[model samples]
Target: MNNAQEARRILRAHRYGALSTLSKKFDGYPFGSITPYLTDHDGSLLILISTLAEHTKNIQNDPRVSLITHDQRDPHIQTQGRVTVVGDAQPEPEREKAGQRYLRYFPEAQTYFAMHDFSFYRIRPVAIRYIGGFGRIHWVNMNNYAVADAEAFVQQEDALLAEVNARSSNALCRLLQQRHGISAMEAHAVGIDCDGLDVYHAEQTWRLDFPETAGIESITESLAQLLTATP
Candidate 1:
């Protein structure tokens, strides 16, 4: 895969990151906080935060922010792949839409979603730093990094997930075992994007990268090939 796609895959595999925002109370100093974020279909991040939160207050004072997430499963922190997104965070106007997608990944956040103080913020990336390994690194080109023709995929995501969960559970189970060596009695497709699919099994989520980029028209065939190719 290209550096950009690899960077996106890393971001999609993990959920939370260290968010750095300009502190409102501390005179524009950098303030860091751990926050859960969803990698949206277009590669932007969606985060739910309370208005009363320190990060939120900082964002209000200045929208400029950055978040870094790395592979948590890797034991060697220095060598593991990571992606840092330098971006601007703004309130997402489409609350219900964002909530639907965000809640699927973070069901426990339902209570927070219902609260009046909580709101969704979209972090649009200005630049991305991707470190593939100790020596593999690159400043991902924005044009190549961004997903093209993503609207169709986003609109069809729910239906696609429903079909996979309802009809392809066994295949998904085998896939988890084949790709991740984790045998699962049941597996559910919680999310799908251009890069790959996210499977929830055994109380944890596993990422399965597609052989190639998949669009709405090719996703079915892409999945079929992926499932059938594995054992």
Candidate 2:
């Protein structure tokens, strides 16, 4: 529907990616790791990694890297949609704040989250390569592909997360039940990276993926209304 919607779609289609880093042991060899990434609203990936991991070591040595995310299920892999983000990889300083959103997406990493060695890394894209499924392959011009820093919602993350989980979540649940005739014991927010928030309701066993970057505040309200209206 919009840039944020399109960005959210691109991210949902491909969750895992190949994170290529310069090998510390080998001078010419590039190291690759399959990583489950969470995309931020502006398209940067929020990766959960540990200082003990090899990729972490590589990233520390050099923050520069190229990360590729795509669907491997396609019969013709090349025909499937793929996005390659080339950027600098570095540890996120706001671990305690962003960790909530990151951990929500990946609950299994809770143990690692507690460990001092584990941390969140953000891939700040310098450029991106987007290949639309089937023959629509073209590199989006930087002007259109990258959202400006001012336009990105990078401040007050902790507050935003808290508000969403509290005010938004409850309202969303009530709306779903009232308008959609949906009933559930609980609603769990499964993921909240950057571009959108993915929530799960106990009754439907289905996911509600809502785009937040476009207008996170407004989108949250719209989703609640949509949920309530659905039958």
Candidate 3:
């Protein structure tokens, strides 16, 4: 895969990151905090933070921010794959719409989601730094990194998920077991993009990369091919 796609895959595989925002109280020094993020369909990030949070206060003063997420499963941190997003964080106007998708990945945040103080912010990346491993690093171009036809995928995601879960759930289970070597009683597709599919099973999310990048028009066929190939 290209550096951009590889970076996106790494981001999709992980959930939480260290968010650094300019501290408003500490004379603009960088303030770091752990935050959970959801990768939006368009490759931006979605983070739910309370108004009272230090990062949120800093963001209100200065939207500039950066977040770094690495492969937590790897014991060797320095050489493991990681992606750093340098971006601007802005309030997401569509609360309910964003909340629906965000909540699916973070159901435990239900209480925070309901509170008035909590709100969704979208971190639109200006540039991305991707480190694949030793001797593999690149500054991915935003033009090549962005997902095309992202809105189409988002609009159809709920319906597509329902259809797949209802009719092809067994295929998903088989795909998970055959590919990841994990057998589970049930499996469901939580998200799908040009790069691959995200499956939730056994109380954890697993990412399955497609053999080839599949556009919105061809995603269903691509998934079917993978499922058919998996025994």
Candidate 4:
């Protein structure tokens, strides 16, 4: 896959990142916090923050921020793929839409959503840094990194994933074992894009990228090929 596609896939695979902001209290020093993020179909980042949180305060003072997310594998972290997004964070004016997608990924946050103090913010990326592995690093322009046609599949994502997890459990397990050698007894599809499936296998997650990107219309055929491929 190209660097842009690889970076987008990595972002979709992991949900948490280290958010770095200019500290409001520390006199311009950088402050970092573990933050959970979800991507809008166009590649902007969505984060839920409480008014009382330090990161929220920092963002209010200065919109400039950066977030880095990496693969969560057990191997050496330095060698794993990672993506750093540099952007400005601002309150999402149309927050109901953000809430819908964020809640799907983090349902437990429903209580926080009900609270008045919490609100969603969208980060508009100005630049991106993607590192696939050693010697595979590059600065990707915004146009190259964002998926322009994501709208074609985002609305149907949840239902598509639900059907796969519910009726195609064995196919998922087979793909996981054949690709990663992890014979997971239980697995559920957590995310889906035109490119691949992200499966939550018990405590760990596995990303299964198709041989080629599949549009919404061809997803069924793409998945069927994997299920029937020689292991």
Best by TM-score: 1
Better of 2 and 4 by lDDT: 4
Output the lDDT of residue 17, model 2: 86
* Collision pairs in model 3: none
* lDDT for predicted candidate 4 compared with the true structure: 0.83
lDDT of 2 at 31: 96
**Evaluation by lDDT, superior candidate among 1 and 3:** 1
Q: What are the per-residue Cα lDDT tens digits for candidate 2 across 165-190?
A: 67566655765566446775566545
lDDT of candidate 4 over 137-216, digit per residue (tens) = 99986677766568877788877777787788888888889888988777887777777777777655577887877777
lDDT of 3 at 221: 92
* lDDT (10s digit) by residue, model 1, range 38-142: 999999999999999999999999999999999777789998999999999999999999999898888889999999999999999999999999889899999
Per-residue lDDT of model 3, residues 148-207, tens digit only? 979999988888788777887888888888887888778888887777878888767788
- Top lDDT model: 1
State every prediction's TM-score relative to the real structure.
Answer: 0.97, 0.72, 0.95, 0.86
User: How far in Å is the alpha carbon of 212 misplaced in model 4?
Assistant: 2.3
lDDT of each: 0.91, 0.65, 0.89, 0.83
Compute the lDDT of residue 207 as modeled in candidate 3.
82
What order do candidates take by lDDT, descending? 1, 3, 4, 2
